[model samples]
Target: MEQKIFDCAIIGGGLAGLTLAIQLADSGCTVILFEKESYPFHKVCGEYISMESYSFLERIGIPLSSMHIPMITEVLVSSVNGNSLTRKLDMGGFGIRRYTLDAAMAKLAVQKGVTLLEQTKVTDIKREGDLFQIKTAQGNFSSKLACGAFGKSSVLERPLGRLTAKSAGEKNYVGVKYHVKTDLPDNRIELHNFNDGYCGISKVDGDVYCLCYLTGSENLSRSGNSIKTMERNILMQNPFLQRYFTHSHFLYDEPLTISQVTFKRKSQVANGILILGDAAGSIAPLCGNGMSLAMHASFIAAPLILDFLKGRLTHQELCMIYEKQWKEHFSKRIKTGERIQHLFGKNILTNAAIGTLKLFPKLADALISMTHGKPF
Candidate 1:
């Protein structure tokens, strides 16, 4: 029998990959998706999504209006000493858990006729002539094109030679997330800074709040890898965080943690495979634009991909266009996020920056606007 070759094979089923798969499948292209974990799994993310992608999600079949998730329009940021600033967000956001969002996307992809492969891990990928060969635990698959949507850190990064010196040299950061029942306002998101880290609290679906934070790995080591100890000793130093931690009823028995979260630069195209989401590049979570950026990349890549598959554009043209568009849309936002991150996580500087922003509210709004993009 002749081997089956899909139009596109996506390595990860997160937001970017799943969104692209659904779009392609809806366009009547053959698409296959591989995900190591099953649906309804939790990930270490802030769970806040920019309103910019609201229409995009609805167009793709996620019924946002029916979900009744919290709509956040205000941002509250605080220094370690509890000095704070509040501003009305011009393009505010909504919060929804990864478990709910990803599972919905996965189901929609399948409904759109995408070949969904759960519990399948892609072991290797290589380009052979015009086709890309993918080896997975299930079996080998072939595709006219491949996309890498596996987020943040992956075992494939080393094999693909994506670990650049800048990424390797940076101080590693760890992220932790928990779902809790708290008194946080549904219309607001709060960011509290402590020593070497910051925490964000926002309401997601099911009337629960997602509390997530990122800290340098050294802080975790110093606390003997005890998340509780790190929170008690370091995070509680901030009065805002102290109040929440002490009062909230945590939903999870243990927090979900991910390590080696790098904000380093990455190439959009690596080894002839298109990379998406955090695989391409990650903005600092402090900006709260990562999810929107990921979905936007899919929105950008899907049309170019269709053009290539239909022969309107050559492979080289497709790659060139995607790379240029990705950079044009995201470079400034990523750079601005990096600069804003520097102002946080330090006692003196964070306090000073908050004080300055509080005095000049318009300046705070401008800085926040720089990290977000116009709705797509």
Candidate 2:
């Protein structure tokens, strides 16, 4: 049997991989994508994409009208103490469940002539002279360039090893998201404080609400398997959350949970393989724009990978370009997210800060700006 050859081989069929596959294919590159799971699958994510991704989505020919996701133009921040502030989001973003977004992007990839291998797991990749030989569970494939769009904790990150021996406080952080049927205003995104965790609620798709939360795993375990109980006891201690948890009803029977989410600054590429999306380095989820960041990184990398394939840039040059461009454009935002995470993770400090913000509403706008970034 003949081995399949492609200009590029993409690993992990998530947003980053599928988006880049479409970019490369539209650029006239023969790309093959290997995904471990079928599309329309659930993931632990915030599912919000900034206005920054709107142009990229359009560039790839995904019509905004075809997307059933909701648009949000406001951000609401509240404290455990009933102190709250709201900001009209300077730039609007869209919300779609990962299950639907991933499927839509994959369909776009197929339409653009990119080969998508569903349920395919890539086992290994080795650089063979000028090209890469990729080994998947199915068969051997060759490509001029390879991309790791695989999300956090995948086999791809193993070889680069740990960024530091210190855990950097990530071990305590866990994330969970739920898709629920509810009637909620589509214009706002709300962050509610629960004991050690924070929950974000917003509309995604036509009628489904995506409620995502991040917290300490130990706190969750101590609650005896009741998320609502944990929220009421630990999270709602904040007067603001107490009001919502007491007044509003959850639309889901039970929520989804993701344990032990860790974040580290990452090198954009290792062993000549380009890294894309969360596989590269994930900003703190509290930063609230990861989906857009992942898509933007893909937009940046597609051209660099293409240049290497075209022999316009050497392998060393390609890595240098990707790392340099990514850090220059994104390092500050990721760092800002880390700082905010530190502030919001503590109870007493968070309350005091929220109180201060309520006193001077401008502070809340500044914080919202920190999360939204420059107008794209």
Cα misplacement distance, residue 312 of candidate 2 (Å): 1.1
lDDT of 2 by residue, 57-87 (tens): 8778778767766889987766656466677
TM-score of each: 0.98, 0.92
Candidate 2 Cα outliers beyond 4 Å, as residue runs: 160-170, 225-228, 239-253, 374-376
Residue 152's C-alpha lDDT in candidate 2?
77
The 10-residue segment with the lowest total lDDT in model 1: 162-171
lDDT of each: 0.93, 0.79
Q: Output the worst ten-in-a-row residue range by lDDT, candidate 2.
A: 159-168
Candidate 2: lDDT of 264?
Answer: 69
Residue 252 error, candidate 2, Å: 5.1
TM-score of 2: 0.92
